[model samples]
Structures are given as structure tokens and as C-alpha cells.
Target: MYDFLLSDEARVLRSEVRDFVKTIPRQLLLDMDADRVQFPKEFLAEAGKRNLMGCRYPREWGGRGLDWVSTVMVMEEIGTLGYIMACTFGVGAELVCDAIIRHGTDAQKEKYVKPLLKGEIFAAECLTEPRGGSDFFGTTTTAEDKGDHYVINGQKRFIVGGEGADYFLVYAKTDPHAKAHKSLTCFIVDRSEGVIVDYIYGLMGCRGGGAARIVFKDAKVPKENIVGSLHGGYAVFNTMMIPERLGTAAMTIGAARPALEVATGYTTRRKAFGREIAKYQGVSFQVAEAAMLLDACRSMAYTTSRAVDAGVPENEIRRLVSESKKFITESCQKVVHNSMQVMGGIGYTNVFPVERIFRDVRLASIWTGTNEVMSLIIASEWYRKYMDDRASGITRDCENDAVEAFAEGEKIYE
Candidate 1:
């Protein structure tokens, strides 16, 4: 369905990524899902060795310098391994590198971005705090200026790779007196000194991705380690949304794909009422619906990737990405749910991978900013853009298209 969206080069890159995906050990997946592993270090290491990590980064930074479309392709292929593996890949390749590339100084990039894409070290985005996840501006984490460096103090919870990551892209309030959007700064906080992983949370799914709470009490970050300018974290954040939200949207589609495939194959063999279950509308319709949902989801993700690549306006990009994330993730849930129902009771068991896929995709709607938040962005941006365009005569005033267009007395206002 997405063939036309890719260039020939992207197709080649996708093949390389698929080859790397094939090399992943099934045992690693099983171990992670069972919580026997905290992080899969070898997974990223092997991907780096194969030069298959971070397709969109510069070749000097150990990337192919591919476009966002290529990265989405990379995401979907890795996504089949399950949520944790794909997310682990994304945290380093997309999330962390995005902030660095967009805002970090050259020295900082050489020090962090190169090693990260090389898979020599792991990275994490430490954003969500004990205060809240969606309300990022409500962060209580603070970094106080102290001449040569700053002392960062606060706690970040539910951080993927919190335990295994060698460094973190941290957001902290740098100016108490300033407005929320201007009060914060982005910093590269190493996992040394005052940085501490105080607790590890047992997650419902996407296990073994090093989900934990990090406590930073007087963690000294050098003035040089700050990303972008002082009090500019919000800009870094708004830009990084392209990777965080869209990456999640694309991955969920790949993650849930197996469920549809597995269920479809089963319907052909699983018998009911002495005939193939697939012959029944109850069964076939579910498969049809799941397939349709995935195709639709793919369209949104691909379109949004193109928009970001085309240099669409920031607000427009925000609306597009939020819609992609919300719609694709929600579709993933229904696809998994439909697949489970189609396969009957056996689908709920570990005998098939449908159950695991179900567990993983269930968190998609909740993470990378919830679908509810996406709705807020969608509505807010739509209204702002539409009104602005209408006032400027860029949009046709279709309000007068009705037959009762001149019935002003009927158009009462309070």
C-alpha cells in the first residue's frame, strides 16, 4: 500500500533493515517479554554493526542521511519485533538524535550523536516527571546556574532506557520567574554523579526496556552540555514531536501487523460448525475490517511523514502528527482486538503471538502523548489555521453556500 510513497533508495534501505530484523534472536524477544531482561544491549549493537540504525541521520554520524519517509520505513520493519525493541531503537535513533541534531552544538553532537548512532552507548529522553506526563510544562525538575555548571535536582518517572541508557536528554526548569514555555532548558545529563535510578516499575507491556524512575539530586551538568540555548527547551520539544509521535504511530502498525496475519491464517484452518470459520461473515468481516484499518493507518503515517519532509508550517505539522499518532494507534488497538476475536479463545493464550501483540499495542494510545491530547491539538490547530486563512481570504467562506444564506434574521446571535 505504501510502495508509491517510497523512493527506490528507501526500498533498498528497507531491505537492509529487514535483513537486520531477521538476525534478531527469538530468545531475546521471549526473555524481554517475560521480564528476564532489563535491556537488550546486543539488539542495538548488532543493528549498529550492520549500519542499519538511524537512517535519517548524516553518514558522518553513522546514519544513511535518509529522509523521514525512510525512517518510518525503518520503524515499521523493526516494529515487528514488538514494542520494546522498536521503542528502544526509536529512543536513541529518533528521539535523542532529533534533539541533538536540531539544537546541540557541533562538539556536543560529535561527543553524543556519533557514539549513539554507533550503538556504542545507549540514550534516553527523561521528560515525564512525578508531577505528570502530559503536562510537561508542570515539571518540577530544576537546574540551578552555578558559574561553570549547574546542579540539577528532581525526579523523572516512566523513562524508557532509564536503567540502561548511558546518558539522557533531560528537560528542567531553568528560570522560575519566566513563563512556562520559556522557563525550561534541555540538557544532556550523563548517568554519572548525582544521577540515580531509584526505582524500576513493572510495566503491563513493552517490558525489559529499562522503564524506571531517575532521581537527580545535585547532578552537575556542565554549561556546555545544555542543548540549544538557555530557556529554549520548549522549541527543542516542539520539534522533537515529529519523531516521538510519528515514530510511535508508524511502529504500532508494524507491531500489530502480525496479529492480523496470524488471525487471517488461522481462519482458513480453524473449523466452526463443521466448516471453515473464514466462510462466516462474523469471521471474514473481522479480518476485512482489520486489513482496512491497517491500510488507512498506513496512509495517515505516510502522508504525515511527507508533510514534515516538505517543510510544512510548524503548527500544521503539529496538527498532522497528532492526528497520525492518535488515529494510527487507535486503529492498531482495533486491529488487534478484531484479530483476537476472530481467532476465538485460543487467541487469548500464549500459544499464539496475538496476545503479546495485543498487550503491546494497548499502550500506544496512552504513550507519546495520549490520544486525548492529540484531539486537543487537532481541534486547536484546525480552528486557528482555519480562522486565520478565512480572515485573509485564503479560504473560501462556504458559510453562505446554503439556500437560506440571506436569512440573516434566522441567524440569531446571543
Candidate 2:
């Protein structure tokens, strides 16, 4: 299915990424885990030289001019290393760079997007507030116009890379009375302003990149720093949401792959009741089930990426994105859970990374819009198509006899 979904060039790109990740020192990953720090500069520089940081951007701006499939390939590789690397180098770049490349003027693109693609500048997305999570419609951050500049004031909570980011891709309300989706606006706010960052929140996992809260107390931002248009936050968000879902799905599946391998190895070697754990059908079946689910999700993610690359219609793309996000993230959560069960005692302990993988994958189902939100999107889309078709007067009128017979046999109910 991957071969059918991904082009030959995309497959080659995937192989290249896998080979690069294979040579990354295990100690490097271990140190990253131990130190709980952002990605080392050396790694980022190497990735930039290899064109992995900007794989999806056009070639005119120091990118490789590849499509989203190539981006997913790199994301999977980074996810294999750890969550911080994936967020900083893969997810962060996609979210920030995509917006700038699509909407920024030439000057904004040169200053922010190009350098970011080359890894000269790192960007962090600041969308969630102290009162906002999945519901980003109620952000209290306000960008007040002051002639040649705008003054931003509010606090952002749980912002990824809030403490150390060179540039912040922030969302602030510019028109409170506009429609709910369009009332806010996005900006490329530099850290030199009067922005105060505080590192206070810690989580069960993904601690390396410094997820902190930022307060902009009358922070001055140039009027030119606004991304897209004033009161156009929805457009900015809509442009990147699909890519965010697709990239996140790929990352989760990649992180789960190692857990699957560890569980398989443990079951084959660990002795229980004078036989290997693999001999127990109960344990073996769990591993087999997990493998299938992971494979299914992987296929869906790659397919969605390819569809996006082919420029599928908006309705179709939305359907695929919602399905891919829900399927891949939810399956990752289940697969990691089964892996822990297969590892038995060691999985629950810090001796293994399975527990960490488990916690990290759970965040996927919640991030980039929760799985529950995905369901709503899917249902709404399906209902719209159904109603549209019905309104078009396209209905089968001669199935009454068949419907009556089926109802008589099965007692169907609505």
C-alpha cells in the first residue's frame, strides 16, 4: 500500500532519511533524554545541509522543492530519535515555515522564512493561551495598533519553545468584534521585544524543548510583522492545520515503531513458566494486533500526505486529514499500550522507554485538535455531502420492496 501511495521518489527519500537516522549516535539520543534540552545546534546544522529542514519548501528559498511526503519522511526519522527533536526540527518548522512561505511578502519571507529553512533561526508557535487549548477562538491576547507599531499584551501558556525561541509565530486578537474564526491575527514577533518567558510547566514527557508560558506586557512589534492579513487568523490556521495533522500522525507512528521492536524482542527472549513468552498465545496475539494497527495507521498517514501533494480537492483533503489524524494517533496510543502490556513489569518501570512512548503518543490524540474534534469534522463533512446529494434530487425511488423485505427480516430502526 505504501508503494502504491508513495511515489518512487518519495520512497527513495524515505530510505535516505532512515539511513541518516540509523547513524545518529544512541548516546546522542540518550543525552538528549537525560539533559532534557533542545536539539543540539550541530544536529540542526547537519539537517539543514542535508536539506531535511526545508524539504517541503520551494527551491528558490534554500529548500529542496519536495512535497509533503518528503517532509513526512524526515518527520518519521526525527520522531524515532525523540519528541523534542521531532517538535523543534520537524513539527515546528512545518507549522511556522508553511505559514510564512504561503502568506508572507518577499521581505518577510527573506528575513524569517528563508533563514528558518536554513536553520539559522528557530521559530516557536505561540497559539494556546492560559485559557485556551483546543478552543483557540477565545484567546485574550490583544494586538493594539499604535501608529507605526502594534502593542501586544497577554500571556501564553504551554507554548512550545517559549523560552528559547528566536522568533515567535504568535496569534493575537486584532478585531474582537469580527466573526469568531476571523477575529484574531497572526504575527512574527521577535524575542527582542518586552516579552517575558517563564519556564514553570513540566510534563510526564517531552520536557527537553522548554514548553513555557510567555507574557507580552505592552510588547512592541513592527506593523510589518503581521502575517497574512489583519483579522485573518483563521486563514493562517486553516492553511497549516492539515499539514500539522499529517505531520503529527507520521511522528507518532515513527515513535511507536521502536516500542514495537522492543516488545517483540522481549517476548522472544524472556522465559515464563519454562517457555519463552512468545510461546504464550495470549501475549503473542497482543503483539500481532499492535503490529497490524500500527501498519494501518502508517499507511493512512502516507496516503494523506500523498493526496495533499497531488492537490486533492478541499473536501476530500479535509476528509482524509481528519481520518488520518484520528486513526494514526488513536492507533499509536493503543499500540504503545499493548507494547507495555507485552513487556510486563519492565515496561511500567523507568528501566524501559515504553512508558515514555506511551505518555507521548497520548498527547497526539489530543494535540493538533483532539480525536473528538476529528470525529466532529468527519461527521459534519459527511452530513453536508449527504444533504447536498439529497438536495440535488438524486435518490433511488424503486428500492421500497427491498427495504420492506430487509426491515421485515432484521427489524431495522433509526
Candidate 3:
């Protein structure tokens, strides 16, 4: 039954990850949620030792040399721990290591990627700034090019791993006078080089791993640290978004699973009117809906990951990825909320894990590009594809079939 979605190898990797997750003490998980355990470097180091840090990266870079589908399996299992742990793993393995693998110079890869995959150092992507939220190209951070170095000055807010990162993949404006997409550049900046962790947020959920505001004031970055070509950060940004968004979608599957399980167990055992609560349509129906939604999201997430592995065109990937992230995250919220509802008031308190999962799942829709932004991208990409096909005289027979069934006079819009 699972053959189409997962191979034997992927299933084995999933078991391995779950085994590792099982070793994490319940107190440690609680400590993380309570904000007492910041960074969780020890946990990450342990994952590194197990060679679970970067399953999809090349073997030479300290990874297992697996495919994107394998990485999704790992993410899903780690996601059961909570959003904080899942995101911390993603920051180094998916976002930072991926950027280096794609665009970093040999020197940069040697210096950063290997250590990153080994969990020797953490990294953060500094893109969102104080003035702009999702207006990535509207970044006011400046990287003034000198003969041998670039002087960077600006602040990035809500940077995951900001407080503990050893290095940052930062995007800054290199040519303010140029078009928004053409004016930007990406750089690898060491945290020791005059970068400041201005503030660590007091988050409502998804705490731990140190999300913070970071300031780079007169930081001198070597010209060699640039990723890809000068003033070509836009391409790099787009490239990273594919994994960033998709990884979040996969992680949400794991996060929501625990909530569903808790609710299922409680409703089955807990009695109401001398029978199990699960016997009632009111409670049982929600469980059924949550199960269906979770399966759909999981299938879409894996399908998108496989497409990524196959190296589909970026624009096509963008549409499917945006759809997956938006739908899965939103669906996860519903699943968790429904789980809480099925358990009644007990699910809302710390007495159960459902409450914590509910809070943690809220951020998935908002981060890695807001769901609204994902919708915008999905619609824009669809329109662009439709127009391109029309301009190229390539008619889609399925679309034409619907038009053919309607009388010409009755086709009101036309």
C-alpha cells in the first residue's frame, strides 16, 4: 500500500529517525517548549554523530548522499518532536547547506558546508528585514563593495538560529539603483565579524533554537564570500525557497500526527454516556476528517519532493511547492485544532500534548512565506503558464473540452 509513496530504504530511514527521536527525554522536550533549553546544540550534535543531520547532502559533505524523498522522511520523523527541533535541523541541512552546494565557491563549501552537515556549526538565512516582510527585494540592508571586502550594514529580524549560528547566508542590496531583482547579492557572513544578536523573541510557540533579531553593522565580509555571481541574489533566493517551503510542509505532517494520535487514544478510551467517545459521530467524524487531510497533505508533500529530485523546471516547481506548503500547513492547523476539539477542554491544557502541538503548528502557515503569499505565487504562476501556452499556440485539450461543451452564446465571459 505504501510502495508508491515510500521505498524500503526510505521506510528504514524513517524508523532510524524515529528511534533517535524516541531517545530524547520527555523532560528535554518540555524544557525546550518552556524556553529553558535554548539552542539544543547537544541534541543536534547527537544527531550529527548518528549521521542524521543531512541525509540528502553529498557523502563528501558529511551527509548520507540520499535523495530529497529521504530527507522528507527524516523531517517528518523529527517533526514529531515539535516545530523547534524540525526547523533547527532544516536550517543547517536544508537551507544553509543547500545554498552552499548550489552556489558556494569551492573554498566556501570547504569552510562551511562540511562543518554544517556534521552539526559542528549552525547557520541562519538572514533575508527578512525590519522594514519589509516578504518584500524580499525591498531589503534595505546594504553591502557596499570595496576592492577586496564588502561592508555590510543592516538588521534582519526573526532569524531562526540567529543567536547560535556560526555563520549566516545574508542577502543585501549591492546595487540600489538597479532593478529590485538585479540589485541584490548574497554573502556568507561569520557571526564573529561584528554581527549582533539584537533580540531573541519571546515566542508564543515554536520556541527553543534561538530565533532572534540580528544586526550587521560595518561588518567586513571578504569578496570571496559571495554566493553565485555579484548582484545575482534573486536567483539564489528563488532556488532556496523550493526546499525551504517544501521542508516545512513535510515537517508539519509529523507535527500534526502526534496530535491526531493523542486525540484518537483519548476519544477511544474516555467514556461518555457509558460508551467510548469515539463511538459518537460528532467526535469520530473529526478524527476521520483529520486522517484524510493528513494523508492528502503527506501525499502532496512527497510528490513535490520527488519532482524536486527529478530537477523539474523552477517555475513549475514553484507552483506545486507553493500549493503544497499552503495547503499542508493550513490543513495541519485544522487537524490539530480538530484533535483538540475531539478531546474537549482537556486538549486545551498542558495535561495533554495536543495543546502544545496546536500552538506549534500555528507558525507553519505564517513562516517560509505566508500562506497568503503562497496563494499569490500559485495564482501568478498558473496565469503565467496559461498565457505562455496560449502565446505559443499550445492549447490544453482538457481546458478546450470544457469550452466545447458550452454553447458560444451561453459562454457569458467569452
Model 3, TM vs. native: 0.95
Better of 2 and 3 by TM-score: 3
lDDT of 1 at 41: 89
Tens-place lDDT per residue, model 1, 1-414, is 688889998999888888888888898999998889888888988887777778888888778878999888889889998977899999987999889988999898899998888889989999998778999899999999999999999999889877789999999999989999999999999999899885375677888888889999999999999999999999999899889999999999899988999999999999988999999998999999999999998889998999988999999999999999999999999999999999989999999989998998888998789899999999999999888998899767898999999886998878
Looking at candidate 2, what is the lDDT of residue 389?
A: 75
For model 2, state the Cα shift of residue 298 in Å: 1.5
Ranking by TM-score: 1, 3, 2
lDDT of 2 at 314: 82
Ranking by lDDT: 1, 3, 2
Task: Report how far residue 189 has shifted in candidate 2, in Å.
Answer: 0.3
- Give the C-alpha lDDT of model 1: 0.91
Model 3 lDDT at residue 99: 89
What ranges in model 1 sit over 4 Å off?
Answer: none
lDDT for each residue of candidate 3 in 1-414, tens digit (9 for 90 to 100): 344666776777778888999998898889878888777787887888788877887788788778888888888889999887899888877998888888888788889988877778888889778886688888999999888999999999988878788899999999999999899999999987679885465788888867889888899999999999899998899899988999999999999999999999999999999999999999999999999999999889889999999999989999999999999999989999999999999999999989889888999998889999999999999999988988888776465577467567765775
Instruction: Report lDDT (CA) for all predictions.
Output: 0.91, 0.79, 0.88
